[model samples]
Target: MPYRHYLLGEDQKSLLDRLVSQFTLAEESHGSLALVYLDTFDWRLHQADLRLVEEDLCGKARIDLRHVDGTLLASGDFPAKVFAWDFPPGSLRQALEPLIEMRALLPVARLGGRRDLYAVLDRREKTVARIEFLAPQVRGNEDNRQALPPRLLVHSLKGFAPEARRLADFLEGPCGLTRSETGLFDESLAALGRRPGDYSSKINHGLTPALPAGQALRQVLRQLFTTLLANQPGVETALDSEFLHDFRVAVRRTRTALAQLKNVLPAREVEAFRKEFAWLGSITSPARDLDVYLLDFPRFQGFLPPEARADLIPFRHFLQRHQRTEYQRLVKHLQSSRFRALVCRWRDFLEQPGGLEETADGMKPIDQVADRRIWKIYRRVLREGQAIGPQSPPAELHELRKTCKKFRYLMEFFQSLYPAEDIGRLIKALKGLQDNLGAYQDLHVQVETLGRFSREMVAEGDTPAETLLALGRLVEGLDRRQAEVREEFSERFARFAREENQRLCRTLFKSSSPEQA
Candidate 1:
């Protein structure tokens, strides 16, 4: 454990000298160090109580991992270039891989400073504790450094708590130093006018129940725009599949917002955006589909006998080749001027005040709008679900799936208007049903895709029979799973359509007048 005490007075050197005398300390190495704090745009590392820093000391670069409180966790020589995958195989990589899976590590703040290291000596001349006074001479944006006040740190070595406690008491009583509530990295960030949790892509508009429908929707659109822009860099770099996933989700939500709150925005503009985003969504789908198959390749292989699993290598290569081709197409389109203009126009429209002149019911309280829409969609879901029998056509189920998606989006958009617990229960129930339907549809698609691959391989005339056999087995396994999921659909839908959930939905979403506009 490490204990930290901040220097409160101007006499930091005096305080250190006093400590050297009182603890019978000896001078240790003292030098200048340049450090850069790193995190994702969303601060994933900091949120997990981890801090990663790249340090340059004496012309050597190293990365250090520490807790928020300044206790060192691990450190290793910095790689020549750092990527999410560059960390050598070790505990540090193991810890970081999950926390920052697909996000890039960005430098949050940079600090260049000098330190005076002192060791508290035991009677036997062994080091018992250590003290370092970090003098931050320059901080913030590297191009324009801002000098900051120096501060002292006390590090307690293991098994020497009593001695460290005594030194802390002396410093607090006579030296006038107080414990710092802020960490060094946080202080540096503040100097640069940033905070740990400043940015997030999650939709949190802080909408109120009484906000006008048009204004509330504009706020939602603004947030979605921000989310879309935030993920664009990741998508362009192909850092991870989630960037594209998030980008596509934002597009879908934007389209959904336009349709659901159609009356609030100008109909022509809304329709135009919907069409554009539909195109955007269409272009992004191939890459995302390929990503899903690549991600699920392991699971697909697991369905095959161990001895035959290697036979799927050709399929893996086929998927990768297609994924690369589709990803390149996606990147080219995303980087195009057309895509840039669309985002700018969408952003400008959403940022406009009062959002187009309100249509009939556009000025209604958002809660009222939400109540009417939620009740209508919920009823539609019920009507459609009830129409599905054991022998219902797959087309009917697909239609129900789309309805559930609309219902889910509405609940999510207006969630702030309702009791969170009640809305949560309703969404949960809907999700269970959606999951079953989604699985059923996805299985069918996968089976069809496998069959197509098998046919293509046979036409190529250079493929092995084992690969085809493996694809057949994979399709059969998926079919079996689809059948099982189909069998469970009744139970899942029953849970979603239970009396308790229905009562909650009706009580929460029942409207005062017929849904209008």
Candidate 2:
């Protein structure tokens, strides 16, 4: 059976009532339902065109996964679960785990109301279709409530397609009802002063070539600042690792912008903020490191023999204990006056208008500045990548990694200034190299981190001999993987530095003319 939902327009309920008088409508069921919509902080499910709802009807709770168009894909009893992993092994868990990943499912919106169900009958008194009228109120904080527009749902029975079509046509033609495009999720979100996909970690500000470099830098900085503030509460609450991850990324991007756009902002202010952001990033590092390890604990266990996997349990416990400790220190630092002052001062500086002319390039057209910076960095990446040899020290690769990050960030920040397809292609090309480098660094970091953790565990006298051996095995595996990744870097960099990409980069970013815009 197909599910259809419509919103009742002005006085349409009376029109629907008058039209339904021609048929025999039998009351099926009615109840008050408490509906709570859930999604990740970044709206991952919403981006996928799916919504997860936990509905309570007369004390019975069920979690449902549905399309944006009111089609139910899966449903199960709503157990006391906060994350995908907490759910028992089932279809709902399977559908959610891949989408939500490590993010916690927070209640995005809540609505409370009564719904009445009626079965539509033909002259023969045979059930043809069912109708549902939902009148829900947005349940908000502090006993605040807002009424939403009423909704009508017509559910087509399996063998009654014609009747269902006729009913829908009648509703559309005379009842003055319209299909709901935004659906309840969006409506409720609106009532709560939020919109779907309102938050994202990616840099996507639109910039024009004619804009002043100072103004352009401010726009990007403001967006990054908003992302930082938006994720702060989630970080303080330790809701999920992604919140911290996004927060850290935003901080890093801010630092990059400050460092790379030195001549676009006042040097003294830029240096001050860069140092503060660096401090911020440093304070948040321990918790994030532990988060990565904990999130990858299963994979770590998989590297060992089945019987030996149990030996890592103590290590898992060790990580958990330290994760809690680090989170506490992290939250304290985030809530401190210094962090607050940094945020306030940064916001004030970004919000200011037209005072950055003291710097060298602040008044230049953004296109000219962007072209020069991007071209310079692109050449630097090429030079650095080409300079690395089979005997190059690991430190060389690390330096190249940092340079690649700066290039990537600059490209992303100014992507809108170039042809979308051309710039997108270049970004895609760089990502391949970035992924290889990222993997190599991660493997290297994990090996060193594991050794440090093993030493810490021994000092604390909490880890057993088996756990130590397990940690040793994990370190060896990581070392091998890191070497393999390092071995692949040459080919990856070769592809990135290929002629086609190089040519495209030169054609797109190497020009400062108005034609580039």
Candidate 3:
């Protein structure tokens, strides 16, 4: 186990001398260094109990993955600028990839410090327990004088708990050292006036069901706008595809809220903002579509033979070029004054205190409105889904997917009003059906996209015959998989529309009033 203590006194030399005299310890190593603490904007690594630091040790940059308790988990040489894919294939990359995903590992804080290493010796002069003293100074702002106080860390070697305890007792009694509540990185963050978990994109407004429909909708929209603004930096920087993905999701959710909570806000303004957001969604789609294609390229390649897979390299290059072009266009639009004005206007609208008093459903209790809308959407889903057989045209399933999305958005928006278990079951069942529909539509789109790519390749005249053949094979594979997904749809929808699920949805979401019920 690792033990940590905060030294109380200001005199470092006297403290070191006293420690040396009190215990059978010898100075082993000492160094002054600068360290940079790293984490995603959302603190994904910290939330997972992982700490990542970059430091200049031995004249080279080294990255260390440490536990929250300051125990070193893994260490490796890292470039000055590094991304997730920059880490070599090993335990560190394997461990970090899932946690950080596409977010950039940004430097959260910098600490310039000196460390002294000491080893406790047994009677036989054999090293047993170890201690480290760290004195950290804030970097980049020398005049602030906001350095982290010195700290002492005790490392208890295996089978030497007694010695560790003795040392702890002596420090607590004579040395006047107390345990520290904060870690080094956290202390550094505090010195810089920052804190962990300061930002998150999750919708966590604790709205009550009895709130007025207009007021509740405004609260929801404001939270989503906050999420949207939070992600704007990431999207503008093109830090990762997820930024745009998240931004678009916020847009979709906002649009859904506006549409679902009809007559709650000013109808004319709502419709105008709806059109503006629709425009936003349209401009974002091309880049997001390309992102999906590039992300799925590996899986697409796996569908071809090894020999044919090599041929797809040209296709990958094509995607990269197109994605860059599309993303640039998207970034330009996102950074435009028009986009900024729209978002500002939308924020003003959502933040406005009251809604039109003459509007229908504007003053109704949110629970009542939610119940009626959810039931209506669920009934529409049943009607649409039941009309489609296994042999139904793909367009029919595509339309049903849209309907399912609307129903899903309603459930998600009003989830807090109903019993958690019942709402969860309903959403879970709907998701299964939606997944099948989604896969089928995606496969169809991929097939069509590949067809267009084939034409482009032919027109370019620089592509090899083998690559075209592989592309054709890839298209056929996608069509076959699309058919397979189509086949699975009937069964998935059956499970979703089963009597148990229908009864659950009705029991939970159906209004208490007999007329509405």
Candidate 4:
């Protein structure tokens, strides 16, 4: 596998304590790892091609090298001796050779014996080092990816490990090859002729930090979830993709927490939590699907002519009404205090020394806690639903619905632990059920939104045949989804629902062993 190495800089001058050459194998193409020390080199940065830098994840940066080619090209201490220009097509090497002659080079004598200072080494290794420098949080990136060779694309300072970021603190600046990146390059170059390893296992191992299975996995999840939540979908349709991602993560983590720290939780509790997550994922499916399909309509319409779009009214109208219905349900579930309480409760449960249900499922100000409480609420709903008729216990069902939402929230919250496949299956099933429920719900809401439109049309006295037709189409679509809930659908859905409910409770109450705890 191709291992990745990063040398992040807080400034343009990353004074990496570890030399680069020792980090790589002597061979031209082999993966190696280390954190050695090196000297420094002089490099120049340009006002052009700053775009070569990665997007600023450390907030923002001051390095702005604007150019038509969208690249910043300038020689730092390790100046490229312009021998030829036959590289990437359409390059400007030919036009800039005269300016790069050694005459144009700043004299080493005048440079105060800067004398190409670099990390001294006796061996060479094969490793590529990339660096990114972000300014202070107020204006993050200073050097970013600009100072290093373009091959080493700097993505974000935030992505760098803590130690790397600490090193970057000394590297960012107006100069190219932040002191840190320069130091790495100098070290690598210095070791050009030396053996790859110094023949010491302790030294090699100490140079590299290895993440253990326990905490490291959690960290990766945290970073990933942070990324997903940062970009919310515009409409419901996009929710599925996010839902899938979030739900799966929760599942994986749920399993991981269960297996790794078996002592921390009981097996039953882990199963209960997983089950609830599965159910929660199921209920949220229709809303996401409806949202996604409807939101994409506007773009899809662009492909048609005006006349075609005019006739497309019924389709668009149906989709819009569908959206309103799904939205109401989603909002109701999201706002339920029951779900909120569960999040706090779940967090408490997870953080505690005991297992999932050492205490009763309690409620709290949900907005204030981690997302798992909602999922517990979801489990609660299924339990409540088990006791009453779907129609007779409207109040109970409504509360049940609330619990379903809580589950979704929880699944989304602890998604870092869940598996993607598990979540995907649950989402598919929920979508199937939601398709019918969502339609019924949409009709329930659209009747109101369209009623006003109808009144307006009547007041204007317009011959709005399309309005009636559009409304009819939507109503029909809703009817169609419900129409199929017959023997086959009933059997399949019923079986799935039973299974889902079981899983919810199973997942809710899962636990681990004391030793593993």
RMSD of 2: 2.6
Residue 304 lDDT, candidate 3, scale 0-100: 93
lDDT per residue as tens, model 1, 220-288: 888888888888887888766778888998888888888877887777788888888999999999999
Q: What residue pairs clash in candidate 1, if any at all?
A: none
Cα displacement (angstroms), candidate 1, residue 285, comes to 1.0
Provide the overall lDDT of each model, using Cα atoms, as 2-decimal numbers: 0.81, 0.87, 0.82, 0.36
Q: Which stretches of candidate 4 lie over 4 Å from their true place?
A: 1-309, 312-379, 383-401, 415-436, 457-463, 485-493, 499-504, 507-517
Between prediction 2 and prediction 4, the one with superior lDDT is 2
Name the top lDDT candidate.
2
- Predicted structure 1, TM vs. truth: 0.87
Whichever of 2 and 3 has more TM-score, that candidate is: 2
What local lDDT score does residue 470 receive in model 4, on the 0 to 100 scale?
Answer: 50
Please state every model's RMSD to the true fold in angstroms.
3.5, 2.6, 2.9, 18.7
By lDDT, the better pick of 1 and 2 is: 2
* Per-model TM values vs. the true structure: 0.87, 0.94, 0.91, 0.32
Tens digit per residue, CA lDDT, model 3, 241-290: 87888899889988888887768888888898889888889999988998
Please give the clash total of every predicted structure, in order.
0, 0, 0, 109
What is the Å distance of residue 339 in model 1 from its true position?
A: 1.7
**How do the residues 170-276 of candidate 2 rate in per-residue lDDT, one tens digit apiece?**
88877667787666777888988989999989887789889999999999999999999999999888898999999999998888888888899888888888899
Candidate 1, poorest ten consecutive residues by summed lDDT = 78-87
